[model samples]
Target: MCTTADESGMTTLPEISLAKLTADETRGEERQRLETACQEYGFFCLVEHSIPKKQIGQAIEASRQFFALPQSIKERYSHAAQNVYPAVARGYGPLHGEILHPEAHTDPKELFGLGIENEGDRRPFAGATRFPDEASAPGFARSLLALQATVLNKVVPQLGTALADMIGMEQGWFQRHFSPPTLMQRVIRYPARGGKCGKHTDGGFFTLVLQEELPTRSLQVWFRGRWMPVPSLPDSLVVNLGDMFQALSDERFKSTPHQVAHSGLSDRISLPFFIYPDIYTRLTSRQGRHSFGVAEMMLRNMESVAAGNGAGRAREL
Candidate 1:
């Protein structure tokens, strides 16, 4: 029963075990808890999931090794520079590469993004991703891609099934639309600068953040009309619904606003796997009156956020 708090206090995000929901014995109760959390908080911590701890550690190390390379070496994969495939949103983004809020300062983070690498794909944001030479960091691309496959194949579908069941849709209804999903895995490094990613909601269905334990809290969520810190939990993935999920649920769920700020003690590294439905798949509300393609909604939301037009408010999907 984790519900919204008044303006004076922070709302606690419930931590649920994904393993329990996948088991028939506990599925009923676990599903109920998930439904409640989605309706109330729109965010939670996932534990007991299928991803191996060793793989998680390896992914973190691979990201660290990649980032530690000299600027000249890392620049070879720069998204802004090497993106011959203009539709592809893959490759590297330098520090302060993006300004999340036009009025606010640039985000104090560097990003390396890799998405479903389908050759000859024409859809927007779909195509092969650029990778650095093995000389820069051996096996970095292979290891990270392996980790991404595990999440896309094993983790995201189960969560989608749970959501469909909660909404009274047939099991696997939502999962079917995500076949050959447009997925992106981003490794982000935040420096100790005072700049923070301004308040904004994600554009897709949901995001799974694999973050290393930090000395102090760096993630914050907008709840109860105030910003509340989300403490770093070990061996857990922070899960949050995005704008498309909010729309697909017909506003029954929320797409909570969140941001990252400087922790001051140490640089932070986070891996976020963004799960998007197929670009052409049209998501319809339960009532059937509203329907929109995932790509269309995502583009509109991104444009709105970039323009600082109602950036803090959830847009209609």
Candidate 2:
């Protein structure tokens, strides 16, 4: 802990093998590595997670084409028209629409987001899933849907079970709460004007991200009072713990602050899957001193967050 970090910052974040983490013979050692990663840094790269790399690329491309559409066509699907839950989470958030930083400023980016779809309940967080029509961008909706289906089937359950075990919870705990889970997926595109997105902790339990194929050290995390760069690798995705998990685990895990600090070069694209407990799920800290519902925390955050004018996601609760 005393050594000064060199230029190759955060180069040693453990890359866990998901296959081994699930196998009976190797689960023990691999679980320890995962536990440490969550508790110490709250972020790491996930490999052998069974997600299709090619599909992720296609989704990114689809997002690129979608964003590249004429401004008029893009605005046609704005969150305002859809009447998003907080008035700015789903459908479309144009450039500089979100405020992820506490200082109340807009991010230099544009995004399209969708929440849980097809559940029996069509409530905001539970079921109100929406996507652009096929006419918006050819195969855009299908590509993202296919990608989400893969993550939901492959990574979410496995990772959730691993975390439940790490915190000493009984079997099926995650499954119980995550039955028809509350999820939000986003495709964001930032232009060549290099700048930093707001620094804030995620509001969900965790996130799985597929970064652009090229090695752009844009994603950074705050650790030990310094920002360290997350390495980008081929055929693997990035994972980070989030606020709900931190509270649910009684802080055994951390919800570290992170940001997208990109250098103006080429357009940057990212696919992030935000996982949460059922919106109605209430969580209590490990020691039982803190308690709150997932919806409550989210609404609290939305009250003063970033829709350009600062009131939807500017800061975390």
Residue 108 of model 2, lDDT score: 86
Ten consecutive residues with minimal summed lDDT in candidate 2?
308-317
Q: Could you say which candidate leads in TM-score?
A: 2
TM-score of each model, paired residue for residue: 0.90, 0.91
Clash totals in order: 0, 6
Candidate 1 at 154: error in angstroms? 1.7
Mind giving the per-residue lDDT tens digits that candidate 1 earns over 145-215?
88988998888888877877776666678768888777867888887655367677787778899888775
Candidate 2, residues 13-71, lDDT tens digits: the string is 66888898999999999999898888778888889998887898889999999999998
